[model samples]
Target: MNHTIQNLEASFQDVKSENSVLKDKIYSLNSSFYQYNFTYSDSFQRQKQFDELQLLQQQQDYMIESMNHTFQNLEASFRDVQSANGVLNGRLDSLNSSFLQQNHSSVDYITKELQLQTQNLSLSLMELNKSRSEDIETLRNIIRSREQDVPKNITSVVNSLKLNDRYLSLSLLDLQNNISMIGTLLQEQQRIQSNQHKLLQMEIQNLTYSFNKSTILLSNLQTRQETTVAFTAGVCNIPGDNKVFSPGQTVIFRQIIYQVGGGYNPSSGIFTAPKTGLYVIFCTNVAEYHETFWTKIMINGSAKAGVMALLRSSNVYIYQSASNLVVHLLQMGDRVWIQVRSGNHLCSDSPETTFSVVMINGSF
Candidate 1:
C-alpha cells in the first residue's frame, strides 16, 4: 500500500511540473494585442480573460503529456526490474549446476588418483624384492666356499650381508609407511570434499528460500497496486449449526448435508469417516458464491486433492449405509479446511455438531 501511494505521488508531482511548463510556453507563444482606440479598463479586463483561457488550455495539454511520460517510465522500470530478477535467478541456477559438476569431476579425479597411488605402492613393494634370486645365489656361494678355504675375513663378510639385510628391511618399512600416509591423505581429502558438498547444498537451500520470499514480496506489491478484485465469502447466521459427512472420501450434498454412510447422522449432525477417499459434502444457507464443501479424499484424517483422481477417473460412493451413519467413520483433523468450508457453521442453539470417521474399503 505504501509503495503504491509513493508511486502515485511521484506521478502527480511530474504532472504538476509539466503543467506549469506548458502554461509558460503557451504564454510566451501568445502575441500581445495593441488597439489604437481602446479604453484602458475594459480592454485590460478582456485581455486578462483571454490569457486565463489560454493558460487553462495549456494545463490540459500538460496533464496529458505528463501522464504518457509517467506511464512509459513506469513500464520501462518494471521491465528492467523483471529482467534483472531473471538474470539473478539464472545465475543462481548456473552456480548450482557448476557446483554439482565440480563435485562430480572431483570425485572422478580422486578415484583415478587413488587407483594410481595404489598401483605405485604395489610397484614399490615389487621392486624391493627384485634381487631375491641374486641374494639366494650369494648365500649358496658362501655355503660352498668350505671351512678349510675360509679366511679369517669370512665372519666379517657374513656380518656385512646381515647388515645389508637389516638396511633392506628398514627401507621396506619406510616404503610401507609412505603408502599408508598417501592412503590417509586421500581419505582426508574425501572427507573435506564431502563437507564442502554439504555446505554448498545448505547455501543453495538458503538461496532458494530467499528468492522465493523476494518473489512473493514483489508479486504482492504489484497486486496491491494497479487493480484488485476481492473475494468475500458471504456469511450465514447459523449461530451454532455446523455439519459433517464421509465416504471418508466422497460426499455430495445438493442442499443439505445428508451425512451419508457411517459418519453422516443428520439427527446427531455428526460425521465420521472410517477409511480414506474423496468426500464431497456441502452446505446450503443464505449465502452466495460460497457453496459446496467438496473435499475429495481424506487420507487417514487429512485431505488429499487427489492428484491421481483425474488420471484414474476414480471417485467414491457416499450414501447413508446405516442408521444416521456415513461409513461409521469420522472425517476430522485434516488439512485444507475453509472456515467457510467445514460444510456449515453450526448454530450454537443446535444440539451437537461434529464430523466422525471409521475405516472402510474404498479406492480414490
Candidate 2:
C-alpha cells in the first residue's frame, strides 16, 4: 500500500505540469489575435484618408481647368472689344472730319453774306442821309426867297406861311417813306443776288463733276478700243515647193488661227490694216538643205526688215531657221506680209516656219 501511493503521487505531479503549459499557450494566442485586429483597423482607416485626399486633388485640378477656360474666354472678349473700339474710333474720326468741313463751309458762307449786307447797308444809309440834308437845305433856301417876296402884312403872311409849312412837312414824310422802301428793296436785291450766286456755284460744281465723269469715260473708251479692236493671227507651215522666192513675193500662210477685224486674207497671204494703227509683224523660216535662207517683212510690197540663216550639211542634214520682226504705223487698208527673199528647200512643214501680225494700237 505504500509503494502504490508513491506512484500515484508522481503521476499527479506530471498531470499538473501539463495542464499549466496548455494554459500558458492559450493566453499567448489571445494576445497575438488582439494585436492583429488593431493593426488591420488602423490600415483601413489610413486607406480611406488617402482615397479622400486623391478625390480632393482631382476636384482642385478640374476647378483649375475651368478657371483657365474662363480666363481664355475673357481674353477673347477683351480683344473683340478692343477691335470694335478701334473701328468705332476710326468711324468717329471720319465723321468728325466731315462735320468740320461742313461747318467750315457754312461759317464761310454766313460770314460772306453778313459782310456784304453790312457794306450795302452802310452805303444806303450814307446816301439817304446826304439826300435828306440836300432836301432840307433846298427847302430852307426856297423859304427864304418866298419870305423876301411875301407882302408886308401880318395876317396874309401868317396864313400863307402855315400852308407852306404843312406842305413841306408832308414832302419830308414822303421822302422818309421812300428811303425806307429803298432800304427794303436793297435787302431783297441782296437776297436774290446771294441765291443766284449759290445757284451759279452749284452749276459750276455739276459741270466739274460731269467733266470728270466724261474724262473717265473717255479713258475707258480708249482702253476698250485698245483691247476690243486688237487683232492677232499666226500662220505656220505654208504649202509650197522647196523653191527660191523673189524679193517682193508674198509668203502665203496656209493656217489661220485668229483674224480679228477681218484683216487677214488666206488666199493672198496679206494682212490688211482695217484701221489706222501700229502693227507688230514677225516671220520665221527654216531651211532643211545646205543653203542660205533669207526672209523679209514687208508693208505695201516694200521691205521693212530682213533675216538670213545658213544651213551647212554634215554627216546628218543640218537645218537652220531665220526670223524677222518689225513694228510700224500703217494707214487704213495698208497691206503687210512676209516673203522669202533668197532661199530654196525651206522647211514648210515645221511649225518653226511662221508668220504673225498683230495690230497693237488704233488711231481715231
Candidate 3:
C-alpha cells in the first residue's frame, strides 16, 4: 500500500510538470500569433499604398491629356484671332491706297484741263491782235486814196477805231479775271483734298494704336493667368493622441508645415482649389493599436485614393500605417480632404500622419 501511494504521487508530479509546459507553449503560440498579425497588417498597409500610387499615376496621365486638349483649343483660338487681325489690317491698307490713288488722279486731271485752257486762251488773243492790225493797214490805204474827201471820212474812221480799241481792252481784262478765278478754285480744291488726306491718315493711326493696345492687353492677361497659377500645402498631426473617428469623418491635420498660394483651411480640414489645374495629393495615416481602418483621399466628397490599415489580432496593440497618393484635375473652388471611410481610432503623433497637395500644372 505504501509503494502504490508513492507511485501515485510521482504520477501527479509528472502530470503537473506536463501541464506547466503546455501552458508555456500556449502562451508562446499566442505571442507568435499576435506578432504575425502585426506584421501582416503592416505589409497589407504597404501594399495598399502601392496600389493607390498606381491609381494616382493613371489619374495624372488622364489629367495631362485633358490639359493638352485644352491647350490645343486655346492655341487654335489665338491663331484665329491673329488671322482675323491680319485680314483687317490688309483691308485697311488697301482702302488707304485706293483713296490716295483716286485723289492723285483727280488732281492730275484738273491740272491738265487748266493747262489746255490756258494754251487756247493765249492762241485766241494772238489771232485777235493779228486781225486788228490787218484791218488798220487796209483802212489807211483806203483813206489815202480818198484824200480829197479826208475831212468827213477821217472823223468817222477815227471814232470807229477808238470804239474797237476799248472793246478789245475790256475782253482782255475779262479773260484775265476768269483765269485768276479758275486758279483760285483749283488751289482751294487741292487744299481741301490735302486736309482730307491728313484726317484719314490720323484716323488710321489711331485705329492702329487702339488695335495694338488691345493686343498687348490680351497678351498681358494671358501671361498673368499663366504666371499666377501656383498652389502647395502640407499639414501634419491630429489634435490628440489616439483620437477616435467615425466613418466619413474628416481627418483634420491641425499643424500646418507650409503653405504657398494658400487654399487650405486647417480648422475645417479642407483644401479648396484656387485655380483650375492638375494637382498631386498625398496622405499618410497610422491606425491606433488594435484598430482597423480605411482612409480615403476625397475630392468633393468622392474617393479618389484610399488605403487600409487592418489589425485582426485581439489583445495585440500594434500601430499600422498606410499611405496613398493621387493626381487629379481640379476646378476652382473644388474641395478636397482626407476622411475615415471605416475606422475607429487613428494615430495622432506628429509626422506620423500627414496630408499634402501641390499643383503640377495650370489649365487654360
lDDT of 3 at 149: 40
Which runs in model 2 stand beyond 4 Å of their true positions?
Answer: 1-248, 312-316
**lDDT winner between candidates 1 and 3:** 3
Reference-based lDDT, residue 358, model 2? 70
Q: Please write out the lDDT profile of model 2 over residues 256-282, one tens digit for every residue.
A: 755556678777777888778777888
Query: How would you order the candidates by lDDT, starting with the best?
Result: 3, 2, 1
TM-score of 1: 0.20
Q: What's the C-alpha lDDT at position 314 in model 2?
A: 53
Backbone clashes in candidate 1 total 59
Q: Could you give the C-alpha RMSD of every candidate to the true structure, in order shown? A: 61.2, 62.3, 70.1
Error of 3 at 295 (Å): 1.5
Least accurate 10 contiguous residues by lDDT in model 3: 145-154
In candidate 1 the C-alpha lDDT for residue 25 amounts to 46
| Ten-residue stretch with the least lDDT total in model 2 | 146-155
The whole-model C-alpha lDDT of candidate 3 against the native structure comes to 0.64
* Stretches of model 1 off by over 4 angstroms after superposition: 1-161, 228-364
In model 1, state the lDDT of residue 274.
37
- Candidate 3 wrong stretches, greater than 4 Å: 1-242
Spell out the clash pairs found in candidate 2.
none
